[model samples]
Every structure is written in C-alpha cells, then in structure tokens.
Target: MKIISSKIVITVLLVFATVLSFAQKDFQGQAYYQTKTSLDMNFGGRQMSEEQKKQIAERMRSSLEKIFILTFNQSESFYKEEEKLEAPAQGGGNMRFRMMGAGGGEYYKNVKEGKLIQQADLYGKQFLIVDSLPKLNWDMGSESKMIGQYLCFKATAVRKVVGGTAMPFGRNNNENQVEAPTEYTVTAWYTPQIPVSQGPSDYWGLPGLILELHDNNTVILCSKIVLNPTEKEKLKVPSKGKVVTTAEYEKIAQEKEAEMRENSGGRNMGGGGRGPF
Candidate 1:
C-alpha cells in the first residue's frame, strides 16, 4: 500500500509541474510606431522670428532621429527579457536619419553622431503589462478602442518641473547652468492583449501594450503588429554615442547652437558661410 501511494504522489507532482510551466505566457511580435513632431523655437525668452523659426525648424528636423531594435525568443522558466538587449560586440546599425528635401529630391541623412546616443535603460524602464496594474494615480478617462483584437484604454501622464540646472555644453564646468527640465505631459493608449506588455520607444508601464502615444505635441501611432515571426534572433542594445543621458545631449546641442549664434553674430542663421545648413 505504501509503495502504491508513493508512485501516485510522484505522478501527481510531475503533472502539476508540467501544467504550471505551460501556464506561463510567452510571445514574439513585430510592431511599428510613427512619430510626428513640431518644433517651437524660442529666442531671448520670446518666440523666434519667422525667418529664425524656419531656420531652427530645418535644424530641428535634421537633428531628431529614432533609435530602437527587434528581438525574437521563446518563453521559458529561465528566460530573462532584459538580457535580450545587451550590447552587441558588432554594434547595432544606426536606425535614425534626417529626411532631406521634398518630393523626388527627398533623401535620408544618417544622424547617429554627437549627443543623440542610443542606449536602452533596463533599470528605470518597465514593460507595459508586466509592470502596470489596474489602478494608478493618474486620470483614466479614455475612449474605448481596439488594437489587434485587444481592448485598449487611454490615459495621460504628466511630469512637472519648476526649476533645474542646465549643462549646455556636455561640460562639467560651473558656467553650464540654466533653468530647464520643464513640465510636460504624455498621453498614451494601451491594450490588454499580447500579454507580455511592451511597446516601441521609452513609453510603457501601462495595463497593456501601448499601441498609440502622444505628448500633445508629438504623436506616435502604431501601424501594424506581427505575431511570432519565423525568425529566431536576439535584440541588441544600441550604442551610446559620445554623450549619454538626455540632459547631457541637450547641453552639447545647446552649446553648439550658442557657438553658431555667436559666430554668426545673430546675422546669418542660415547659409553656407557659417556651416552646413
């Protein structure tokens, strides 16, 4: 009787373990996000002149670029999602570029230099569904929407700042100080489907995968979703350019702009004489 009981216990344990393992979810998908941005240039605490705005707009369009990557794997007990984005010895190819000219003349200029570095942050970053719960402190008012068969909810996230120091030249000198950090809000739409809880860019931490997100000024929309592609590969973390951190990048950019302004003596904001337009 004792021997029979032991056999029955071992069989039940094995079955339970198998079931538990299968209960864990694993998925692989492809998604594309589009962003539309508008630049508001300010000079001397006032709005920039029309001509100045145009020049700044051109520069802004040339400077901004998006950086991200794709990965593939199976869900398993030992799987660590964050490890998938470690730095690759060969480095990930540059993904951001500038759209030059209009119509037939339009072309792309790779802009992976200077302060705009690409590095994935695993500490402060959180995947949408994996991190968020049903309740949050922010407002949840949103229209019902569907994304890839999953019901989505919209919400806004606001970040406010009163005063902060600025390092306008990627320098640690005392001269690099100004009130900046500024206040802004980001609104996003998410869905409960696709269980893993991830999204393009730095936006995440929602009850579901973020399908569409915007900051009132910048719009990022999801165009498509691909599920379990045949390709099985790993995601590589992007390289960190000469400068790291958004603050450091801004400082370097600001210093460059200041130098350009000084060299031009505020006369010629555009033209070949100063430098590349």
Candidate 2:
C-alpha cells in the first residue's frame, strides 16, 4: 500500500504528542490572593454605647462584605457562600450610627433596617483546595515559616460540628430554631515556593499553599501574593447561601439577633449589634 499508509500516520502522530506532553505537565500555575480577617466581640453582655461600639464596628464591616468571596486558580479558594442582596434591603445601618449618630434622633431611630444579610459562618466555612490533600489525619510538621520570601510550612487540622438547622428569618416561619454543633481548631500555613496551593480565606488544606489561618478567635492573614497573569482565571466555588454549617451559621446569627430585638419594639439597643472588624 502507500508505504503502509505512511507508517500508520506516523504512529498516530506520536501518540498524540505524548498525550499533549503529559497534559502540559499536569497544569498547575495561578496565584493571587489577599485575605485579612479579625473579629473579637463580646460586648460583655450588651450595654455598648461608645456610639454603640462604633455602631458595632460598622455593622461588623458590612457583615464581612457579605460573607467572603475571593478566588484564583493554581490555588486559592475562600467562598463560604451566602450573598443574595442585589439591592434588596440595601446595606443596612451602623456606619457608626450613620456617620456619628444624630441623623434622626431617638438613638438612631430604633434601627432595624434590612437587606444586608450574611448570618454568620464567618472565616472560611468551606471551599478549601489550596494544594489539595489533607482533609484530616493530622501531623504535618515542618514550620520553617517566612511568608514574604515564601518558605513556609506548618499544618494542623481538626474539624467537627455535628448537628444543624437554623434559619433566623428570610425563610422558615415558626420563628426557626435548632442547635448543637460547635467544635473547631484549625491552624495552617503553607508555601511550596508558590507552586500553587492557594491560601487566604476559607483556608485550603495544605501540602503547599496557605499563607496563614486560624480558628477559635478567627484570624485569616495572607496579606498578599500575586503571580502569573494574563488577566487571571480559574478559582470559583461559591453557593451555599441561606446559611449552612459553621454551627448552622451561628444558630442563624443568634436567631437574627433575637429577631432584630423583637422587631425593635423593645429597644434597649446597647451593644447587641454585630461586626467583623
């Protein structure tokens, strides 16, 4: 035949170019993240009034910008869901009592606004795949730490919170309620010389790529890390709104702050506000 059909088409094009060069060397490259979280509020049993603790730390920094959202492929994912507010009740109150109180008297006129949701599940409640592998089985020692020069290593994981069901309003009548499930202790840090294993927010399980993280007083700090560009892409996984997990989103944010203090008809309004400052 025509020279044995040109040697079977050059051995099927050299086995499809060696499987596209081993799928481009098992593709892995993409980074850029900035995660900063710090929250501490006890108000020691309400009675705030330092302008309501600066309007409960500006409504806990606008409810932590509507419960986190930051992504980037090649490693980095922190999207603990819940973000439906395209102009519904609008970014509800407490910008330090609307710019230093006295906007309409009556201690900011029985504040009870709405729309600005995000009923808890704070720091990285889910979505973590930085460098994959390590969902729990502890003992990952190596702490050489450096962060800025990228040489970090340190890992510790333990997650468990078994019971759920809480809907502090927005759906679920009968004044929703159901609790039990609180246990956490997560500490992480990673940096396989930025070979991607992302970090910052919902901190991913590390093998190489988690700048720093914490649980039990929430503290997500990755500050900065940006690399490889062409208009970034790949890093998305958000969708668990209406609260879920993280102790049923803190029991639907304490039953929506006691149903906004009984519809604000019983205002003692001290420091029962909220924040993520």
Query: What's each prediction's TM-score?
Result: 0.48, 0.26
Location of the lowest summed lDDT over 10 successive residues in candidate 2: 101-110
What is the TM-score of candidate 2?
A: 0.26
Where model 2 places Cα greater than 4 Å from the true spot, the runs are 1-148, 157-167, 170-180, 190-211, 214-219, 224-256, 259-261, 264-277
Score each candidate by Cα lDDT. 0.40, 0.40
**lDDT by residue for model 1 (234-263), tens:** 443333324244444334434544565455
Cα lDDT tens digits for candidate 2, 1-277: 6754554465345445444422442343333333333443332223555675665556555333333333443323333323455443334343221111101100000011211122222223322111222245545774455666565667877765432233232233344332323546667776655434444433344555666666444455555554444454544433333434334443544454455545654332222212221
TM-score of 1: 0.48
Best by TM-score: 1
